[model samples]
Target chain A: MVVLTVLSLAMWLLTVHDANFSRMGQLGLVSILGWTYFVGLVLVTMGFANELLRTPLRKTWLLVFVLLLALYIFGTGSAVEPIASLPDSYRHAGLLEFIFQNGYARPHYVADFSWPGAFSLGSVFVAFAGQTNALGFTRWFPFFIELLYLAPLIVIVRSIGVGRRAAWFGIALFYTTDWIEQDYFSPQALGYFYLLVIMAAVFATWRAKPSPLFAGLRKNLHFRMARSRRALQLSRLKERGADPSPGTEPTSLSVFDSWRPRLVSAAKARRPKLVSVFDSWRLKPNPPIFGTQVVIQRRYVHGRVASLFARLEGRDTTKSLNTVQTLGVLGLLVLIMFALAMSHELTPYALILMLAGCLISRHLGRPELLAVAVLLALGWLSLGASDYWLGHLSDIFGGFGQIGSTLTDNVANRIAGSSVHQFAVNIRIYIILGIYLLAGVGVLRRATDSRVLEVVAVAPFFLLVVSSYVGEGLLRVVLYALPFTSLLAASAILPQQSGLIRSWLPDFRIFRYGRSSHTVIWTLVFSIVLASALATTVARGGNDDYESFTKGELDAVNYVYNHVTPGATVGTISPYLPFNQRSVGSVYWVSLYTSGSPTIKEITTGLLQIHAQYVVLSQSQENWGEIVAGFPKGWESRVFLSLATHGFHVVAAWPTASVLQVDPKIAKKG
Target chain B: MSGFLVASAASLSTSPAELIVMVVDFLLLSIRACSGVLGLRLTSRDSRILTSATVFFVALFIVLVVVRFKSLG
Candidate 1:
């Protein structure tokens, strides 16, 4: 633990020293994170698990503090004070300022203003802080938001009936593997907090006791299957169910010979080699393994954890709620849902999907809660966000069902950068695939548990089948699914008690590699957690080199704000720079994506048309053009040269940015 | 009521994303209602019938939304 703390501080120091906005590399991380950081991480994971298992509540406060600081150091540590990793953070600050000064959302300025709850909240926060804008709070926003999530995370984990060790493992893994970067200051980030809080509150207040309907069904199925077993030579489950013991193994080869799966190994062997990496989780028919080493591997720990849940329940399990308490909780959920509906365009949908999953799984006791979420979300989609989607209806459905294209947009195109960036992308893809694979194993392996957590984990993927939000919907879905996936992944090694379905077990080849000892399994689980945590730490900051801006660029834009007239139209090749942080509505902010990706001629015409007085070009714009828009590398230089040569002249040039004054002859259009 | 449903369907730009959300929402509601019926937890046969009728309308809405989205696309 001490070593890990030192390493985290070291990484923070290095990032502060070396990170800047010149090179578009992996996650803007300076080159301080190396093998030593990973080694320290492995130690940390080992120590954390050991501490948790030995004493569930011992030193947990310290654990939370250390993990949060490490995550902050890895995510946005290099950033200048009051600024964050992405330019979007600054734009968010601008939106808050617009709301603060104007007192209402301004539609059509940005799609964000259309759903203005988060910005309004930020406005409120800044006013409370006696600050002009949210700029004073943006830098630590991600850290604070992530910290806010830890409490609800514990409650959600408790709902799964896991032990303290498994819950801690799940929480740690969630922080470790989360690379979606949505935790930054945005609507989705706050929406995420609301979603978690609502889920936790619902689980605590409304969870129903386990009923025996499935048990009766499983009993009937068991009787029918056992009667057919004599004729069919099926691996008889009578002994397994009656005994509830792992040592009672199969006596003969006849039981094993009788089991022929619907997905026969022969047919599975014929699958194309290219899908080998995903072969383990290839949506095939796989049944539970009873009385084999797997039963021994999984069921024994179940009894132990069964006792652990009483302790794991923390002070907040679901109990009988009176009318007043129920109403209070319901009101709170409604308020959060309304803010979420008005704040984010996508997370409301994600929340509805999860609630719908809970309803289908019978985990949700209140159907009205699900209805509330759906009505709120759909209502907002039809009203609050109509302006955004009405014009962008094509964008909403443009990438529908285009899995290959969406994957390419999210993954393939991003992999085509510098060697370091390519390596970082590969690592990211590997870690993502690896974690899902572990989660898939957990789902299949724990089939007897009704797979409630697994079902919730999968509920959001349906959103991807219809629309990809410029490839970001998939990322947000992944982000929203991360907590559930982390819980499911923890269950892979943390053996769980079987539900009624455990009686219908199939052949048990999957458990061939199971270990009988608890200590060994603990080691293996912690090792997996640590390795993933280390790789995620590296990948999170790999692109920090170019994505984050320096003080010089901010200073140049600050100079523009100090000098330029209030009504001046400021332009850029792309939406970069800190220009719009002040004068919200008075200054016209134009960029290529918002005004239709324009040609050089269109840019000149548009600049003259708007009578643009000030223009700023910075490194972040150059990086966006090169990486996202496929503007050939160094095209920014040619465009800037042309601008300087023609009408725009350099007024205040910083090392990382330039402020240009447009020719005075172009008169302002009416 | 059916005419009102038809009119509501006609008024909006039924993109694939919208259709999918509509379909998912209806299906989940139907599943929840069906769980209640199948569990023998519904108050009466009238409640069961109402749930079944909702399922019917949900299915109909899904088909209409899909067809509209397809034709538009």
Candidate 2:
């Protein structure tokens, strides 16, 4: 496995070295990636599959394979591209530069300024490193941030009560299915990391312990339900063939049984057991599970919480932190939550929803922890981000309950780009739906004592129903749910069938592959994961045709930034170039195709109207026009020609990027 | 909230709005501290004191947050 991993890494290095960014198509980097890249991916996939399918899972080999896979998925863009891929990353760097220079975030400049924790931290790093700006970090931020996510991800997977193999597979599946491109050099990425850390700490240190009052209520409810089931002859119907008819007496009620006999006897008597049902619930000794028996359980959580906990309680034997360690973890979690609240706008809300789900399913102890998170999030928004909400209250509350439109904006509007981009978008949607479908299967097949994972996996969807989060709500919610959803999806292939709810679906003994059932299952898992990884490779990098900038383009942007005075206006046909790394608030940026593509006359008129001093026309902006906005292939050239004829002149030009400045006489006339 | 305080101070600007934010923020910090202490599994006396502190500070925080909301409106 180690040798395979090393070979894969070497292959990746060769592929990146041989790759040419100039030949990228609308399908993005995957269009240009060579056979060596594919070979590297296959090697890593084979290594991981081998590690996962074997007994007594080798942790070291599995981790190496997983890290190699992460590198292939996340590091390729940074290595293959001449510069950072996204314009937003450069904008974030510009924000960090501003904060480092001024020691403050300039409110009213951009909404992100109001939540400046991430930029401030980046500023501190830049100052400490004696660097002028954060531009250098932007190139490899995705790879670094994804690696940071691995630690918490491991803790979360292990602590969730999925078997060891399922946990490991889930981690790998998470990397492959993570096509959501939010892991840039941005606040949301760091905020997400903080969220994962908090969840890991919670799952590692806490177990569900019901209050005395709730315990008594649950006990009485269970006893009454048992009586009712007996009265209805449900138990007799379920255990029809298992009757002790020969001459022997019935055994005692077994706590581990799907149906306890004490409750059964009480139901037969029908009076005193109903009376002692009011007695406090007591802990029963742990026992082994009966073979392959499906447990019929109530789905509603109101009265069934105790039995639910009883059935699932000992599955999570991983959490063994003593009181002091637990308390210390709680403190660290609160501090992280505070930082998260100050860093990003939406993640704190996501955390609150997830924590609430945990509290509901009894995965989290200390109810006050949830309240603290809520207060911290709300309090920070109301206070720290006051400038953002003071005048834009409608932006905060207007989208509430508009689920239909939110879906349209997030899903429908995204699928209308170029044919290639449309295909990528469709594959992204299918990948999400596929993971979710597998998770549904896992939920029905896996035996578990608690509903914590299900609750958490479903909880993030509520964020979508409430607000569109400026049209990225669906993406954010999917990201928040991906870890748990991946774990559940893994359970579809490797379910641990010995818990509270053994299996909702009846078994058909379909694993008739003779002694090769394990091989069959492993093959199914590998095929599914490899297919998803291939699809995700395209889906994740599909936008790179326009999003990834070239060195010439970066130099073009830097040339404009260095020449333009403060408060000067810079014009572009689209907002796809790497132009926002300097003079953020002082310089104004006007893009003609910001909302919609326009004619050459419109571009010329708009530039003259804004009295723009310099306009940058780059290959990326042209690609955006043709590929995304459906403009003519050479429209930018025509627009540049019209501008040059009217007032603009080419001051400097690169192979793929060019800068045009308005003639001084024409500017004076305007 | 501590992050907010440090960031706000580093900006070297303050106003009545900021003061109102500080009041609510301090109350939130107090509630958070009390909640943390209560989670420590302390002696009965300390637990009682912390519980009382949490409730009191939570109430104060709620009032201040509401007031600030009103002022913003």
User: Evaluated with TM-score, which candidate comes out highest?
Assistant: 2
**In candidate 2, which residue pairs get closer than 3 Å at backbone N, Cα or C atoms, i.e. clash?**
A312-A449
* lDDT (tens digit, per residue) of candidate 1 on A326-398: 6567668878888888888888888888887766554565555666576567655554565566656677777
Q: Recovered native contacts in candidate 2, as a fraction?
A: 0.18
lDDT over C-alpha atoms for residue A318 of model 2: 33
For each of the candidates, give the backbone clash count.
9, 1
Task: Score each candidate by Cα lDDT.
Answer: 0.63, 0.77
Residue A633's lDDT within candidate 1 is 71
Span of 10 residues, lowest total lDDT, candidate 1 chain A: A307-316
Residue lDDT tens for model 2, A1-670 = 7699889999999999998999999999899999999898988888888888877779999999999889999999989998898889989999889888877788678888888888888888888989999998999999999999999999998887888888999999999999998999999999999999999988877665422223223345556444433333323433555554343322212222334443333233322332243222211122112211112132113224433433232222234676457667767887898888888999998898898788777677555667678777877777677777776776876787899999998999888768988999999999999999999998988887677899999898998866898888999999999999999999888887676556777644443212467677768777887888898999999999999999999999899888998999999888888877887799888877754657778887888788899999999998998888888888889989899887899999999999999988888888
lDDT of 1: 0.63
Pairs of residues clashing in candidate 1: A26-A542, A26-A543, A27-A541, A27-A542, A27-A543, A27-A544, A28-A543, A28-A544, A28-A545
Residues B1-73, model 2: lDDT tens digits: 2336664554335334434544554555444445445564455456446556655666666676666666664
Q: What's the DockQ for every one of the candidates?
A: 0.09, 0.22
TM-score of chain A of 2: 0.87
